[model samples]
Target: SIYRMNFAASLCKRVNIRELVTNVPAYAGATELSGGGLALVFRRWATKKTAGSTKNGRDSNPKNLGVKKFGGERVIPGNIIVRQRGTRFHPGNYVGIGKDHTLYALKEGNVKFE
Candidate 1:
Protein backbone atom coordinates (compact mmCIF):
# COMPACT_ATOMS: atom_id res chain seq x y z
CA SER A 1 0.00 0.00 0.00
CA ILE A 2 2.80 2.41 0.82
CA TYR A 3 4.61 1.52 -2.41
CA ARG A 4 1.43 2.12 -4.48
CA MET A 5 0.84 5.45 -2.76
CA ASN A 6 4.43 6.48 -3.43
CA PHE A 7 4.14 5.44 -7.08
CA ALA A 8 0.95 7.54 -7.48
CA ALA A 9 2.66 10.52 -5.83
CA SER A 10 5.65 10.13 -8.17
CA LEU A 11 3.29 10.06 -11.20
CA CYS A 12 1.55 13.24 -9.96
CA LYS A 13 4.94 14.92 -9.54
CA ARG A 14 6.00 13.84 -13.05
CA VAL A 15 2.81 15.22 -14.57
CA ASN A 16 3.25 18.64 -12.97
CA ILE A 17 0.44 20.57 -14.64
CA ARG A 18 -0.91 23.73 -13.03
CA GLU A 19 -4.36 23.97 -14.57
CA LEU A 20 -6.79 22.37 -17.05
CA VAL A 21 -9.73 24.03 -18.78
CA THR A 22 -12.59 22.81 -20.97
CA ASN A 23 -13.51 24.46 -24.27
CA VAL A 24 -16.98 26.06 -24.23
CA PRO A 25 -19.39 26.16 -27.19
CA ALA A 26 -20.54 29.62 -28.16
CA TYR A 27 -23.80 30.86 -29.89
CA ALA A 28 -25.65 27.67 -29.02
CA GLY A 29 -27.82 26.27 -26.22
CA ALA A 30 -29.79 23.10 -25.47
CA THR A 31 -32.59 22.50 -28.00
CA GLU A 32 -34.95 21.07 -25.33
CA LEU A 33 -34.98 22.61 -21.86
CA SER A 34 -35.65 20.44 -18.79
CA GLY A 35 -36.83 23.43 -16.74
CA GLY A 36 -39.90 25.00 -18.40
CA GLY A 37 -38.49 28.54 -18.18
CA LEU A 38 -36.89 28.76 -21.69
CA ALA A 39 -38.93 31.15 -23.85
CA LEU A 40 -36.47 33.58 -25.43
CA VAL A 41 -33.62 32.68 -27.78
CA PHE A 42 -30.29 32.11 -26.03
CA ARG A 43 -27.65 34.18 -27.84
CA ARG A 44 -24.54 36.23 -27.08
CA TRP A 45 -24.76 40.02 -27.28
CA ALA A 46 -22.01 42.25 -28.74
CA THR A 47 -20.62 45.33 -27.04
CA LYS A 48 -19.26 48.51 -28.75
CA LYS A 49 -16.88 51.16 -27.42
CA THR A 50 -17.69 54.84 -27.90
CA ALA A 51 -14.93 57.42 -28.46
CA GLY A 52 -16.51 60.58 -27.14
CA SER A 53 -15.20 64.03 -27.95
CA THR A 54 -13.01 65.93 -25.47
CA LYS A 55 -14.31 69.08 -23.80
CA ASN A 56 -10.96 70.84 -24.34
CA GLY A 57 -10.88 72.26 -27.87
CA ARG A 58 -7.50 70.66 -28.72
CA ASP A 59 -7.48 67.54 -30.89
CA SER A 60 -6.62 64.28 -29.11
CA ASN A 61 -3.95 63.32 -31.68
CA PRO A 62 -0.22 63.92 -31.03
CA LYS A 63 -0.60 63.69 -27.24
CA ASN A 64 3.22 64.16 -26.86
CA LEU A 65 3.29 61.25 -24.40
CA GLY A 66 6.73 61.41 -22.89
CA VAL A 67 9.27 59.33 -20.97
CA LYS A 68 8.69 55.59 -21.42
CA LYS A 69 11.96 54.90 -19.55
CA PHE A 70 12.95 56.80 -16.44
CA GLY A 71 16.26 57.59 -14.72
CA GLY A 72 18.64 54.83 -13.37
CA GLU A 73 16.62 51.98 -14.98
CA ARG A 74 18.66 49.20 -16.52
CA VAL A 75 18.11 48.76 -20.27
CA ILE A 76 19.45 46.46 -22.93
CA PRO A 77 20.76 47.40 -26.38
CA GLY A 78 17.87 48.65 -28.58
CA ASN A 79 15.22 49.08 -25.87
CA ILE A 80 12.51 51.68 -26.51
CA ILE A 81 12.52 54.05 -23.56
CA VAL A 82 9.74 56.45 -24.51
CA ARG A 83 7.34 57.25 -27.37
CA GLN A 84 6.34 60.83 -27.94
CA ARG A 85 4.80 63.08 -30.61
CA GLY A 86 7.25 66.01 -30.24
CA THR A 87 10.85 66.76 -29.26
CA ARG A 88 10.30 66.83 -25.52
CA PHE A 89 13.44 65.06 -24.27
CA HIS A 90 16.64 65.15 -26.31
CA PRO A 91 18.83 62.06 -26.79
CA GLY A 92 22.31 61.62 -25.27
CA ASN A 93 25.02 58.97 -25.67
CA TYR A 94 23.64 55.41 -25.98
CA VAL A 95 20.14 56.87 -26.56
CA GLY A 96 18.33 57.96 -29.69
CA ILE A 97 14.92 58.98 -30.97
CA GLY A 98 13.01 58.41 -34.17
CA LYS A 99 11.50 60.84 -36.65
CA ASP A 100 8.15 60.51 -34.88
CA HIS A 101 9.86 61.53 -31.63
CA THR A 102 10.09 57.98 -30.20
CA LEU A 103 13.04 57.82 -27.83
CA TYR A 104 15.02 54.57 -27.62
CA ALA A 105 18.33 53.19 -26.39
CA LEU A 106 21.18 52.77 -28.81
CA LYS A 107 23.36 50.75 -26.41
CA GLU A 108 23.00 48.58 -23.35
CA GLY A 109 23.32 50.73 -20.26
CA ASN A 110 21.44 52.20 -17.29
CA VAL A 111 18.87 54.86 -18.26
CA LYS A 112 19.40 58.44 -17.19
CA PHE A 113 16.48 60.84 -17.86
CA GLU A 114 17.33 64.53 -17.71
Candidate 2:
Protein backbone atom coordinates (compact mmCIF):
# COMPACT_ATOMS: atom_id res chain seq x y z
CA SER A 1 0.00 0.00 0.00
CA ILE A 2 2.79 2.38 0.82
CA TYR A 3 4.53 1.72 -2.53
CA ARG A 4 1.24 2.04 -4.43
CA MET A 5 0.38 5.34 -2.72
CA ASN A 6 3.83 6.78 -3.49
CA PHE A 7 3.49 5.81 -7.16
CA ALA A 8 -0.02 7.32 -7.42
CA ALA A 9 1.06 10.55 -5.67
CA SER A 10 4.03 10.90 -8.07
CA LEU A 11 1.81 10.35 -11.11
CA CYS A 12 -0.76 12.91 -9.90
CA LYS A 13 2.04 15.47 -9.25
CA ARG A 14 3.20 15.13 -12.86
CA VAL A 15 -0.36 15.67 -14.22
CA ASN A 16 -0.91 18.59 -11.75
CA ILE A 17 -3.97 16.84 -10.26
CA ARG A 18 -4.76 16.11 -6.60
CA GLU A 19 -1.58 14.50 -5.31
CA LEU A 20 -2.73 14.10 -1.68
CA VAL A 21 -5.28 11.36 -1.18
CA THR A 22 -7.97 11.91 1.51
CA ASN A 23 -8.57 9.02 3.97
CA VAL A 24 -5.86 7.09 2.15
CA PRO A 25 -5.02 4.88 5.16
CA ALA A 26 -8.65 3.79 5.64
CA TYR A 27 -9.10 3.05 1.93
CA ALA A 28 -5.73 1.34 1.38
CA GLY A 29 -6.80 -1.77 3.31
CA ALA A 30 -10.47 -1.67 2.24
CA THR A 31 -11.89 -4.80 0.59
CA GLU A 32 -15.41 -6.20 0.24
CA LEU A 33 -18.15 -3.92 1.57
CA SER A 34 -20.71 -5.17 4.09
CA GLY A 35 -24.49 -4.55 4.00
CA GLY A 36 -23.94 -1.66 6.41
CA GLY A 37 -21.77 0.11 3.84
CA LEU A 38 -24.25 2.09 1.83
CA ALA A 39 -23.47 5.07 -0.35
CA LEU A 40 -26.02 7.74 -1.16
CA VAL A 41 -25.57 10.07 -4.12
CA PHE A 42 -27.08 13.54 -4.35
CA ARG A 43 -27.35 16.09 -7.13
CA ARG A 44 -27.99 19.85 -6.97
CA TRP A 45 -30.47 21.63 -9.23
CA ALA A 46 -29.83 24.91 -11.04
CA THR A 47 -30.57 28.11 -9.06
CA LYS A 48 -31.30 31.57 -10.38
CA LYS A 49 -28.56 34.17 -9.85
CA THR A 50 -29.78 37.54 -8.55
CA ALA A 51 -27.70 40.67 -8.86
CA GLY A 52 -27.70 44.01 -6.91
CA SER A 53 -29.98 44.96 -3.96
CA THR A 54 -33.71 44.30 -3.91
CA LYS A 55 -36.49 46.41 -2.37
CA ASN A 56 -39.17 43.70 -2.40
CA GLY A 57 -39.56 40.02 -3.36
CA ARG A 58 -40.83 41.07 -6.80
CA ASP A 59 -38.02 43.53 -7.38
CA SER A 60 -36.18 42.73 -10.66
CA ASN A 61 -37.80 39.28 -10.70
CA PRO A 62 -38.73 37.85 -14.07
CA LYS A 63 -42.25 36.54 -14.76
CA ASN A 64 -40.73 33.50 -16.52
CA LEU A 65 -43.20 33.98 -19.36
CA GLY A 66 -41.93 33.28 -22.84
CA VAL A 67 -42.06 30.81 -25.74
CA LYS A 68 -43.68 27.49 -24.76
CA LYS A 69 -43.57 25.54 -28.02
CA PHE A 70 -40.66 24.33 -30.10
CA GLY A 71 -40.50 24.53 -33.90
CA GLY A 72 -41.25 20.80 -34.48
CA GLU A 73 -43.62 20.29 -31.53
CA ARG A 74 -47.25 19.24 -32.06
CA VAL A 75 -49.68 22.00 -31.16
CA ILE A 76 -53.48 21.74 -30.83
CA PRO A 77 -56.07 24.31 -31.76
CA GLY A 78 -55.91 27.52 -29.67
CA ASN A 79 -52.66 26.41 -28.05
CA ILE A 80 -50.33 29.27 -27.36
CA ILE A 81 -46.98 28.76 -29.13
CA VAL A 82 -45.26 32.00 -28.25
CA ARG A 83 -46.02 34.59 -25.56
CA GLN A 84 -44.64 38.07 -26.11
CA ARG A 85 -45.52 41.68 -25.34
CA GLY A 86 -44.93 42.81 -28.94
CA THR A 87 -45.11 41.20 -32.36
CA ARG A 88 -41.87 39.32 -32.68
CA PHE A 89 -42.98 36.71 -35.22
CA HIS A 90 -45.92 37.17 -37.60
CA PRO A 91 -48.47 34.36 -37.56
CA GLY A 92 -48.77 32.22 -40.67
CA ASN A 93 -50.60 29.12 -42.00
CA TYR A 94 -52.52 27.26 -39.26
CA VAL A 95 -51.71 29.96 -36.71
CA GLY A 96 -53.46 32.99 -35.28
CA ILE A 97 -52.27 36.27 -33.77
CA GLY A 98 -53.79 37.28 -30.43
CA LYS A 99 -54.46 40.86 -29.25
CA ASP A 100 -51.26 40.73 -27.20
CA HIS A 101 -49.35 39.87 -30.42
CA THR A 102 -48.79 36.30 -29.20
CA LEU A 103 -48.82 33.47 -31.70
CA TYR A 104 -51.17 30.49 -31.19
CA ALA A 105 -51.99 27.41 -33.19
CA LEU A 106 -55.25 27.65 -35.09
CA LYS A 107 -55.55 23.89 -35.63
CA GLU A 108 -54.06 20.58 -34.55
CA GLY A 109 -50.78 20.28 -36.43
CA ASN A 110 -47.03 20.27 -36.00
CA VAL A 111 -45.55 23.72 -35.39
CA LYS A 112 -43.94 24.89 -38.65
CA PHE A 113 -43.40 28.64 -38.63
CA GLU A 114 -40.20 30.32 -39.75
Candidate 3:
Protein backbone atom coordinates (compact mmCIF):
# COMPACT_ATOMS: atom_id res chain seq x y z
CA SER A 1 0.00 0.00 0.00
CA ILE A 2 1.17 3.56 -0.74
CA TYR A 3 0.25 6.77 1.07
CA ARG A 4 0.38 10.19 -0.49
CA MET A 5 0.70 13.56 1.27
CA ASN A 6 0.22 16.97 -0.30
CA PHE A 7 1.89 20.07 1.11
CA ALA A 8 0.94 23.63 0.31
CA ALA A 9 3.58 26.31 0.03
CA SER A 10 3.11 30.04 -0.13
CA LEU A 11 5.26 32.43 -2.10
CA CYS A 12 6.25 35.81 -0.70
CA LYS A 13 5.79 38.84 -2.87
CA ARG A 14 9.02 40.51 -3.95
CA VAL A 15 9.45 43.87 -2.23
CA ASN A 16 10.92 47.05 -3.66
CA ILE A 17 13.80 49.02 -2.18
CA ARG A 18 11.68 51.33 -0.01
CA GLU A 19 9.37 48.62 1.24
CA LEU A 20 12.27 46.22 1.71
CA VAL A 21 13.99 48.72 4.01
CA THR A 22 10.92 49.69 6.05
CA ASN A 23 9.02 46.44 6.14
CA VAL A 24 11.65 43.74 6.43
CA PRO A 25 12.66 42.88 9.99
CA ALA A 26 16.10 43.90 11.18
CA TYR A 27 16.72 45.43 7.76
CA ALA A 28 19.91 47.48 7.70
CA GLY A 29 21.27 49.62 4.89
CA ALA A 30 23.01 46.68 3.22
CA THR A 31 22.84 43.16 4.58
CA GLU A 32 24.20 39.78 3.60
CA LEU A 33 22.07 36.80 4.37
CA SER A 34 23.54 33.55 5.51
CA GLY A 35 22.85 31.08 2.66
CA GLY A 36 24.01 33.21 -0.24
CA GLY A 37 21.42 35.97 -0.29
CA LEU A 38 22.05 39.72 -0.43
CA ALA A 39 19.90 42.70 0.42
CA LEU A 40 20.54 46.20 -0.97
CA VAL A 41 18.97 49.10 0.89
CA PHE A 42 18.76 52.89 0.61
CA ARG A 43 17.01 56.01 1.92
CA ARG A 44 15.23 58.92 0.24
CA TRP A 45 16.98 62.29 0.13
CA ALA A 46 17.84 65.07 -2.35
CA THR A 47 20.57 67.61 -2.94
CA LYS A 48 21.75 70.15 -5.50
CA LYS A 49 24.93 70.10 -7.57
CA THR A 50 26.60 72.20 -10.23
CA ALA A 51 26.38 71.16 -13.88
CA GLY A 52 27.08 72.74 -17.23
CA SER A 53 25.31 76.11 -17.49
CA THR A 54 22.18 76.31 -19.72
CA LYS A 55 23.09 79.56 -21.50
CA ASN A 56 23.03 81.07 -17.96
CA GLY A 57 25.70 80.07 -15.45
CA ARG A 58 24.07 78.68 -12.35
CA ASP A 59 23.95 75.57 -10.15
CA SER A 60 20.89 73.35 -10.00
CA ASN A 61 19.57 70.17 -8.47
CA PRO A 62 21.48 68.06 -10.88
CA LYS A 63 21.92 64.90 -8.86
CA ASN A 64 20.22 62.93 -6.12
CA LEU A 65 22.43 61.43 -3.45
CA GLY A 66 21.70 58.39 -1.36
CA VAL A 67 23.28 55.40 0.31
CA LYS A 68 25.92 53.78 -1.86
CA LYS A 69 26.97 50.50 -0.29
CA PHE A 70 26.69 48.28 2.76
CA GLY A 71 28.79 45.32 3.84
CA GLY A 72 28.17 42.12 5.79
CA GLU A 73 29.22 38.49 6.00
CA ARG A 74 27.57 35.58 4.21
CA VAL A 75 26.64 32.58 6.31
CA ILE A 76 25.46 29.05 5.76
CA PRO A 77 22.73 27.53 7.87
CA GLY A 78 24.00 24.85 10.23
CA ASN A 79 27.36 25.06 8.54
CA ILE A 80 30.38 27.29 8.10
CA ILE A 81 29.63 30.22 5.82
CA VAL A 82 31.96 32.54 3.96
CA ARG A 83 31.44 36.03 2.59
CA GLN A 84 31.49 35.86 -1.15
CA ARG A 85 32.79 38.83 -3.09
CA GLY A 86 30.14 41.15 -4.58
CA THR A 87 29.55 44.66 -5.88
CA ARG A 88 26.81 47.24 -5.19
CA PHE A 89 25.51 50.26 -7.05
CA HIS A 90 24.55 53.81 -6.06
CA PRO A 91 21.20 55.68 -5.93
CA GLY A 92 20.08 52.58 -3.97
CA ASN A 93 19.34 50.96 -7.26
CA TYR A 94 20.96 47.67 -8.20
CA VAL A 95 23.61 45.02 -7.50
CA GLY A 96 26.08 43.33 -9.79
CA ILE A 97 28.09 40.17 -9.52
CA GLY A 98 31.20 38.76 -11.20
CA LYS A 99 33.23 40.52 -13.86
CA ASP A 100 31.39 41.81 -16.92
CA HIS A 101 28.08 41.39 -15.10
CA THR A 102 25.15 43.20 -16.63
CA LEU A 103 23.68 46.15 -14.72
CA TYR A 104 20.12 46.31 -13.48
CA ALA A 105 18.16 49.41 -12.51
CA LEU A 106 15.93 49.44 -9.50
CA LYS A 107 12.26 50.31 -9.76
CA GLU A 108 11.52 53.97 -9.12
CA GLY A 109 9.11 53.81 -6.15
CA ASN A 110 7.82 50.88 -4.17
CA VAL A 111 8.44 47.81 -6.32
CA LYS A 112 7.59 44.19 -5.95
CA PHE A 113 9.62 41.36 -7.39
CA GLU A 114 7.93 38.23 -8.57
Best by lDDT: 2
For candidate 1, the 10 contiguous residues with the lowest summed lDDT are 15-24
* lDDT tens digits, residue span 1-114, model 1: 999999889877743122232233454356433333323444667878888987887665666576767889988877889887677777888777788878898888899866
> Which candidate gets the maximum TM-score versus the true structure?
2
Per-residue lDDT tens digits for candidate 2, residues 1-114, read 999999889866653223222223333333532324242334466798988896786656675557889889998998999988888778889889988888899899998767
Model 1 ranges with Cα > 4 A deviation: 1-64
lDDT of 3: 0.34
Candidate 2 yields a Cα-based lDDT of 0.72
Better of 2 and 3 by lDDT: 2
Q: In candidate 3, which residue ranges exceed 4 Å CA deviation?
A: 1-36, 51-114
Compared with the true structure, the alpha-carbon lDDT of candidate 1 equals 0.70
Tens-digit lDDT string for candidate 3 (4-53) = 22222223445456644434334543344432334444555576786865
Local accuracy by lDDT, each model:
0.70, 0.72, 0.34
